[model samples]
Target: MSSSIYSTRRWRKLRAAKLALQPLCEPCSRRGKLVPAYSVDHIKAIAAGGDPYPALDGLMSMCVSCHSIKTNARDNPHAFGKGWKAAFKGCDLDGRPLDPDHPFLASSEG
Candidate 1:
């Protein structure tokens, strides 16, 4: 079952609009894949102090698999470990990490 916030009409409309704006899974696309989006996810989770109704850029379109992986990593960190966000296997064509949140990229930012 989804959270009560997700069941709200406002959230539903935002979700639809996000999907329409970005039909492809954002993470998969970054990895050079062309997977269709199955859900809209908040880039910054509400529980983490993100705005519930943030702008389109604050949302991400994700396929079911990616969504599940991200959710498990974020919501169940104890079971999956803190590194779960970078757990997606394989790399892009240029040998770059598929996960944008990979530590390699984070380190490079500075």
Candidate 2:
């Protein structure tokens, strides 16, 4: 279908998921914290030489600061994307949580 249409649908689903996961931020849950999630994360970013698709399962709800820090971690390692941090803060989990959208959406289209 059309790319823009796809983008719109993707955005809606992502936003819906974020709203549903409110008060249970994935990033925080992973860290053993229970805080309201506000920001969505992209497993791969547009600037990382990847596709321009909205993150699906990769779209995790986190605080604004956590989201920024995660993005920074993806962009830079030693500082934020270090070893274990890279594993948690870097890439998205495998196997899509929902059948409609994979748990982890790759920034790359292919």
Candidate 3:
């Protein structure tokens, strides 16, 4: 059994809608990978004062692997150590970084 919030019909509908909207994992897609998403995560955690049911844009679709990585990094930072943020390695077909937070994606001033 999961938490009450997760078991609610509203939450279920929202999760389903989000998954339908983005069947592929957002992070994986950014990495140029075509992995199916198995989870719908809140962009801002409800425990952190985020809306319990925000718009679709406020949610993220993620595969089990990406979801676990994000959850661990956010909920158990100490356990993951200092280098937890950039846990994903390797590059896309264009040689661009696979990690969404990679410096290559950052805006560079001319």
Per-model CA lDDT versus the true structure: 0.79, 0.53, 0.76
TM-score for candidate 1, please give it. Answer: 0.74
Tens digits of lDDT, candidate 1, 7-100: 8999999999999999999888877789999999886678767788899988889998888888888777684644445655557677777565
Candidate 2 residue spans exceeding 4 A from truth: 1-13, 21-23, 49-51, 74-78, 82-110
For each candidate in turn, the TM-score is 0.74, 0.48, 0.72
Model 1: clashing residue pairs? none
Candidate 3 backbone overlaps, count: 0
Residue pair clashes in candidate 3: none
Kindly provide the TM-score of model 2 when superposed on the true structure, using C-alpha atoms: 0.48
Over 16-61, each residue of candidate 3 has an lDDT whose tens digit, in order, gives 9999999999778877789999999886678767777879977889
Ten residues in sequence with the least summed lDDT for candidate 3:
101-110
Model 3 spans > 4 angstroms off: 1-3, 80-84, 88-110
What's the best-to-worst order under TM-score? Answer: 1, 3, 2
Please say which candidate is ahead in TM-score: 1 or 2. 1
